[model samples]
Target: MGGIDREKVKGSFHRQAKTYDQYARVQKRVVANLLDQVRKEVGTPGRILDVGCGTGKLLAELHRLHPEAQLFGADLALGMCITAGAHLAAGAFVTADAESLPFIDGAFNLVTSTSTYQWLPALDHAFAEARRVLAPGGIFLFALFGERTLFELKDAHYQALKREGEVEDITHRFFPPSRVEAALAGAGFDQWRVESTLEVELHADVPALLKSLKKIGAGNASPRASAGLYGRKRMLAMMDIYQEKYGTTDGIPATYEVIYGAGRCP
Candidate 1:
């Protein structure tokens, strides 16, 4: 939390907002599961808050499920907020930081986030904020990428870098399920449950896969700007290394470790 630069992170998402939907297939799938779990936990919430609600895809679905309930969407990206506003059904769309929500305490009956919490610098504070904004007995449901996500690619990248006599961490940052569960508990939430799942997909090559990740702005998060680090030579090297190590009988594979969790505010 202390090391976070909120403005930089927000700007990063804003820059990629226009193309986010194109590469959000993985996110969409995870969010669908999160929604199903939320439905099971609470039949129909009277009011819902969609935190980090990227292009409002999940919000659109929620609107369909509970047409009468008040809905609100919040994200750090202004462009995403505008895009979501155009598609969502008469709901308020605000460009706001998830760590410090601009709402009164107990403002929502249910809070949901998808593929967004991993971007936060402080999961603990974010969980506290989620709990703070929810009414008593409200449900908080979210899906986030975990440490196991992109393990193959990360290992390949590291190995390649080591071969080139470079020591670099190309892995995306995310908390494990146990840490996430502890954060929720420390934030004073009750009835918490969390689980992890590995979702894998095949790609023709690393470039195709990297393009998909870039389109969603889900690339490296080292705060070291992509323009310089993601040059042609480095990219080609990464592809070659990935093919050499992880290519399967079908094609090159990518795995995403998706962590889903829900907690109730008591």
Candidate 2:
């Protein structure tokens, strides 16, 4: 459980490929924001690479905005690639890994990823690979969850387990903003600027929130797996604790802390 297994992670997304678009609200928002940032800084580009291009939604938007650009979409999941090929603009889809892009170096002027970097087993290598694939002065726009995401739930779950004299491991993993920024810098990206904004959404209950995450093929893709089954009693107790702690003015509670970052490749 040192790091994520890329094949297993890819398979999870592949299984959810057909239904990913239906439940990817956070992803959609993040990608739109990333695209907007790109437009503001880099304007229209002649070539673009959509890394971890889930269903090619971002690629489609880019193609519409910059139709002249050669847009390429890459995802580790073949199913995602196929789905993207069918949904995205013609000639803009490929199956590839983020850490090892197949295209030549400096081929793309803009590289964008939406809601998919956290699952990478090695962020430094991935960032370096992304920098290598980008042309000089190219832009890299991405969105990932920060360490604060699901804090209440994670804390409550672990606290409950610890209180019961048991240890539990969760599948989700998130890095701090500073750590992410350092990785980007270490990857040789210059003019780097990173910012994180909190995005909270209300959920009727934990099950609903968990279901949405699963539908998007985004949950605990890390190599670490949860031990001890969360039975009905434990789940209910956990929910009670979460509600007591995080319930808002409204009846429903909120989950998720989304972090967005964008930088330029030197």
What is the C-alpha local distance difference test score of each model?
A: 0.83, 0.78
Per-candidate TM-scores read 0.93, 0.91
Best by TM-score: 1
True-vs-predicted CA distance for residue 121, candidate 1, Å:
1.4
In angstroms, the error of model 2 at 171 is 3.5
Error of 2 at 110 (Å): 0.5
Give model 1's TM-score versus the native structure.
Answer: 0.93
lDDT of 1 by residue, 74-143 (tens): 9999988988998885789998888889999999999999998888776888999999999998999998
TM-score of 2: 0.91
| lDDT, candidate 1, at 13 | 79
- lDDT for 201 in candidate 1 is 76
